[model samples]
Target chain A: MNLNIEVNNNVLTAMPGDTILDALNRHGMNVPTLCHLKGLMPSGACRMCVVEVEGRKNLVTSCSEPVMDGMKIQTHSARVIESRKTIVELLLSNHPDDCLYCERNGSCELQKLAEDLNVRERRISGNKNNYKLDVSSASIVRDPAKCILCGRCVRVCEEIEGVSAIEFVGRGSKTFIDTSFNHGLNVSTCVNCGQCIMVCPTGALKEKPHIDEIKTKLADPTKTVVIQYAPSITISLAEEFGFKPGQNIGGIMNAALRRIGFNFVFDTSFSADLTIMEEASELVHRITTGGTLPMITSCCPGWVKYAEEFQHDILPNLSSCKSPQQMMGAIIKSYFAEAEGINPADIYSVSVMPCTAKKFEQQREEMTQNGISDVDAVLTTRELARLIRLFGIDMDKISPELADSPLGTRSSAGKIFGVSGGVMEAAIRSAHYFITGKELIKFQVNAVRGLAGRKEAKVMINGLEIGVAVVSGLKNAEILMEEVRNGRKDIHFIEVMACPGGCINGGGQPIGTNEESLRARMKSLYEIDEHDAIKVSHKNPYIIELYDKFLGKPLGHKSHHLLHTNYQERDVN
Target chain B: MKSKVEEILQQYPNAGRDSLIPILQSVQESLGFLSEESVVQVSKFLKMPASKIFGVATFYNQFRFTQPGKYHVMVCRGTACHVLGSATVLEEIEKYLKVKPGMTTKDKIFSLEVVACIGACGLAPVISINGEFHAKVTTESIQSIFETYRNREV
Candidate 1:
């Protein structure tokens, strides 16, 4: 069903399903859009796309309005321009005029639109809405005053990523996006995925600033800053520095870190393998003892935070193990520091991750084991890019190198931890080995592998069908939980990560990744998985050596003291 | 909606003042307003005092205890709204009502609320007075729309 619409002295043809803006864009008419994210549907909130309909008495938002046959529309009329200019002026009035100092100054859509619309000044005399900047968490910053409330952050959290931590609070002039009950991100149900920051047009949302602090510490001669990279960071960090998506610069990354004056270069994948040993054993213990049904995986800090907030009723079901990063931090301070005969206080631990939530997770009071913060500071993949650019490291020419000893060496099981369902698969490999005392021939668990919202698999472990469910994104988790509550779900174990596609598609990774980018990155992860010799966590020499020398065994007295954690039921109010 | 409300109320016969907010929300969802009879029924259903329910209904701004005007006009005064010339829209609404925000005219034709952001910044100067979202509102449009609703009521 083709429709003909008269728009701006031109007759434009459109399909029945085409929105007015869609028709305009097809006809080479650019209707300004801000909140209409490509992956999501039209919100029609930003008035910049207002166009005059000939029959209608007033202008209609082209984004939401559908084009009909024989409809007369003016894409650029005097009234339409006036209306758009007014909207832009108004948006600028309340917005913080600090773009010169903003990190997103050159990249901001709002700034571009303001300039395009020729909004010179705000004629309306109004005081800026003052909202206290929130720096409660390590990963993300919340500057309420600069927030346009376009709901891109809210929509991204709820629709795409499926973590509904942010929502509209208060009524009329007082309305703002708030974490549950006006609490700080640290105290709220937010998973700290940082997707909100990714979609935010203004500087209202950002990774918590640590550049100055890191610089100050680097200037201190007494401090030994050791930098570590997550396995996923190797796959995505190149994109931020103008390299194509999925470019591997592991050696260049290490070189870049050394250039930035880091004393030691390590990998989180080493601890990732360690996490598999502990987590896999814990899963087996639960299965044998008839403990919490469907013991939840705790590799992702965002997922852990979500479990702490809305699902505290099922706290016992969560694995007692800390995240791989935290596990690394605790081990570095205790085992590695002691082994090297170095004071833990003098060792500054820095983790470069594809997760913003890791920052918030590191700040957990319980994470501090020996009077010092386990991980001193966390830099996101994007932050690492900034550092790389600051140091003028030519990423294209550099050769990929291996990470440092014991703590940096990783297995295929650890490398796969970057993708969704990888953690479950890794844990299963270790669990099989731990139970049978034999290496499993077929390393891959095909049942739990994919990008589906919720997946369930039943594995015949020694003739017993071990039920396991894998869910990515919090909304999917909610659906699975409802099924559990209603007695409809029958799973012995579950893996839940807050971000879509798990840590590979983390909130703190490089921005502007589309379907192609995701595919490319996913391919790189699987390639790493297929090439590695040590495919299981228990098979990793470092993990086996660590247990033999220091930790004794998984869930042992010493392991329990450092590796496990307890959760507290949060106040819902 | 009413049947669902009745069923929910029956499930919580021993509910006290704590159940007031949920009961009020359920009631509002059903009748669109917390009527006197519904409030009494809620009090009797929960086995709590009627005064307590009334007190809670009036406390939360979300509770619309009174009958709404024929045309509900909620002008967003949120930070996003303020930046988008919402004040001019508010003035236009006041001119039509001959009363300030949070008040209805003598004819009970329109009720107003200076609401926060409706999460529609793209179409700023938005108003969802009676559940119908009107975006990019101008001074002329507000006056003409008021007459349209006022004429319908008369």
Candidate 2:
């Protein structure tokens, strides 16, 4: 084999160790792929990318085939197209024919492939296998009938999240993805991260939607339905309404929710500020009072559940603060209810979040009070978009509206809770102030700011140099956890977000999201941080006023009762 | 059962991920099948999930998931046996036993398994009761074959 390959009479250079698809892609030629995921080892399970080689008798899967020197390649020859089109038609033969009512009707890769390959006729019709829908998981719903057996969800759950909750069960035509013992996902070691939902190309995996339940609650006049949206939700929700990737649609979202008959709209960033106040105070107290060193952040429910299941020993190292969504829900049920003279039971608290695990997080035992859940319903960012569309509210015509007062205001520190390292940056700002009574000169901590799965930084406050690490993605978190388990010191605080790049890239954010959108969302969050006036959580007036009136101090008795919680080890695995 | 699973895991103290199939086979050999408890212990030892372990176990038809009964039955489904009407003979055993392949009887009296080819095709359409071959099995012969084992004490 030579160093150069001829593709359709054009000479193309092949890099060492480059796959045929990689070389073609580098030369601006694109071949469709179904089971291929970037940054993962190619399994060549799906033959969607078949290319013709000069001397080869049969077509080869370009994703797994290495480029040979002095080779003639035809990417879309007649034979290759026939093979691809036939493959799609065969896959559709057994696939359920319910695209209109399917959750992934618009975004499904299989449907798109059928259209792309012009597979208009059912030349190869076969019997459709009926599969039982698995809706046992709190955060995700699984419809096995719609699955194309691409194995993307299985691979992502195993390679990226390291959860391996689902696997390719059985063999041959009888093969399908299933949990252990075929006993649904609830009994499996699934952490409810929703990452599999994000990677799934079809509607087989989706967030367990609360939109229908939320609509019933909204129509009830006797119930006061108030909604709270996570900090990352505003920027990510724009893409669903034909807006830009990182457009901040908070104001329009507020107006839309109110127009949809929500009694009040609250920003979860307010409680994010509340969380920072308590979490930073807890970190400082741990340092000075000789409490557990290197207190990990418990803001991401996916990470919390992961630690509970996988890292049981590190439970004490986790901060006792509830996540921002749950914290806001707790306050809304307790303080907001009493102040407004409304019964907590009559108030149906709804939260819109970017992460699916927040759905599971809000339903946690400690997230409720007196048999009533703090957050009655949890809608994903995608679900919130569907709700807005269901109401026929045109977001383009809606004007920017402010969040309701008392429990609605927040600082930039609270707003930055959307991105991966945002929690650590916000907490560091407050922890610095809590330790030395002075804020840091630079609010943006550059070391922990990028989309890298893991990052580490250090800060000097009053001659005490403290080390901190920020990690996103459970697989990366597993590596850091190994070091911590092996007795690594010098790191005082660690922040972990289960989804890669944090809430902006959460499982419930949006379908058909790409790398560019993720980067754009992160940029928009930082741009907001760079310009906002109140840059620290302590400076939020609502938080300050709450401390003075409702709560005595951060980590105080009342704050502990409402804003803090504990975690118990789960033996699901 | 947990301690016994622990003992099997102890045999592969320095085992890694690749040792999974061998270890699973060993456990199945001892326990007659891969029990949920054994799967959990193997998962913990390999630092993997039981779901993945189950997937691998189900891929090959060799592994069983249910305990074998006192009289384990194997029916050959090879090309020779299949052409000679083993399908009907197997169906008769399933109907008489009231259990599917890879499943045991409710009373733990019999466990029936369908094998792709046990290489006993010289006497086509064969059935084995406790490794004792009843060559040239017929559909009507299944009842009398089970009656022979049903009346016998362990």
Candidate 3:
């Protein structure tokens, strides 16, 4: 299977499965590539790797073309160079020359490729296709003009995460990646997972800007700016500051927030434990009262948005309890504000999440029950990284500090809520306790753990079998729904998270999370859970105190007024 | 024998506006044309106004609401096909038919349309006449293809 290849007049040896690019790279030839990410397959769309292959009619994209025996490949022949130049020029024709003001100017792959290819001027004079920038979500932006239609976003959504929210619509020059029925991301079945922004080559996808608002708040002497960091953020945030992925910089993160001049620093995990108490009670009540079967977890904002958009018919299946962040927001305004004797309006509750959909979720009119939004502005992990750098905080050199008390002391079940299947496991822990009134000997529910695209498990509770299904990706959710529509076996409960690895790998988290980082982060999450003294949410003293003081109890009249929400059917057409 | 309209209605049980293009395309591919009876069946199955369906079928370039010519000539305008001078081949086809793209000859011998990438970029400048691919096409090749179709008609 050995092949003798002559690329760029230099002889090289290759194997049967080696691509033309692979052979050239082995020979120390540096060819330009943009869409060839290490983990993903080469899409051959950039056309920068064009090479003239002997016996082939035209220049073939070397990244996709396999090496054959005695193949004479010309990597930089006049025709091949011309083809590459033309492709680069065509790409440049639509690209704006606003790199000076761009956030990712020097770091952008597309910008570097244009410079490497020496594209001084665009040969084509076609008008650039213009689109109104979409800043509706907190963590992501959509600038269609900057998009090259390389389909890196679409590929990542489908291949990496198993969600196909964005797809190529129309033909040729008119083609662009759009949500189904050409609707906006807010209206479409988009989970706002922000993975698309991470893989995007240009500024077409970016984190929603909240630095200005934060700066304004920091400048105000009267208003108190409170920031709460999700549990998963600490494990993933270090990667953005050049620390290796899954490096524990929790103390450093707390210090950074303190350095950022926030009036109060809190942890969402405290509210996460509270969410478990409420969600767990709801699950038990449904089981006892013969309510909706397969009650879905509504913690992940992206999954909730997807449920509202495409699965409106199944709204009754969604848990009535608000997400941990929203629950935290509500608690901060009502309980914390009342306890401190401060005006709820003056206290700005900001949640730092590894998700973009939380931004949109916060803006929903229903979320503003107590006159003001429970959560104000939201920031992704990357946005927080940018803010940290702006404040001149050396994240590595800083010492870690503990999160604020009362709302910061959280159980192991609360910490695990950052990862996929964590919500189901947390609910099950509390549900088991609430139903049996005795602690389950085995806390770990192996049935609902892992990164399975579609996972299902059955547990017998009080002689009643409860069927549960976990869906991480929206497309996988679609497949599961299709099965349900086709009269598949009825289930008692389901948990759906939009992101593949759930909130830990949220769209707003730092990119470049490889297999090693994923494994490390997952390990940290389980470690956090196992090392904790309180593994169950129902056992959390703070949650019990909150229920006794303010909310009364789970599904109480006050809890229902502030924490529950209804879904609306979206017009797909 | 069941009318062509009845045959179409049997194929699409729950016809709607969304299925109109696919159904009409399927009917045209099978019967080689849209007949009065088939149109009625489409109207009935889709529960759509016949005039509305007809309007849509005629608007899209892919739809063939009327009868096709004796010869179905599709010149690919895909990126690969265009790079290999399929435009010139199409021009030669127009010269022979004395008509433009998406037109049928008075003699009902030739019809033409430019299709997007047919996924046959390896063999550039491809032309398909009655579902047969003729790769690496030229004016001479197009002329020969037309003559072959004309002879078959005769």
Better of 1 and 2 by TM-score: 2
DockQ of each: 0.03, 0.80, 0.03
Query: What would the per-residue lDDT of candidate 2 be over residues A1-573, giving only the tens digit for each residue?
Result: 337999988999998788999999888999999999877889788899989999999999999999888889998899999999999999989888888999888889999999999999999999996899998888999998888888988888887788888999889998999998888788788888998888888889999989989889888999999999999888999999989998988899889999999998999999999999999999999988999878999999999998999899999999999999988988888888989999999999999998889888978888887888878889998999999999999999999898899888999999999999999999999999999898789888999999999999988888998899999989888899899888988899999998888999899989987789999899999999999999999999889888888989998899888888999999986
> Candidate 3 falls in which docking quality class?
incorrect
Q: What is the TM-score of each candidate against the true structure?
A: 0.75, 0.97, 0.73
> Chain A of model 3, TM-score against the native?
0.87
The candidate that achieves the highest DockQ relative to the unseen native structure: 2
Interface RMSD of each: 11.7, 0.8, 11.6
lDDT of 1 at A498: 84
Each candidate's chain A: what TM-score?
0.88, 0.98, 0.87
Q: Report the Cα lDDT for residue B76, model 2.
A: 93
User: lDDT for every model?
Assistant: 0.80, 0.90, 0.78
Q: Write the per-residue lDDT of candidate 3 for residues A471-559, one digit (tens) a residue.
A: 87676776787777677756877888887767777878775555567777877888888788899988888888888889998888988
Candidates in order: C-alpha RMSD to true structure: 11.3, 1.9, 10.7
Tell me, by lDDT, which candidate is best: 2
Which residue runs does candidate 2 get wrong by more than 4 Å? A1-4
Model 3 CA RMSD to the hidden true structure, in angstroms: 10.7
lDDT of 1 by residue, A176-210 (tens): 77764355766554678897887788788889866
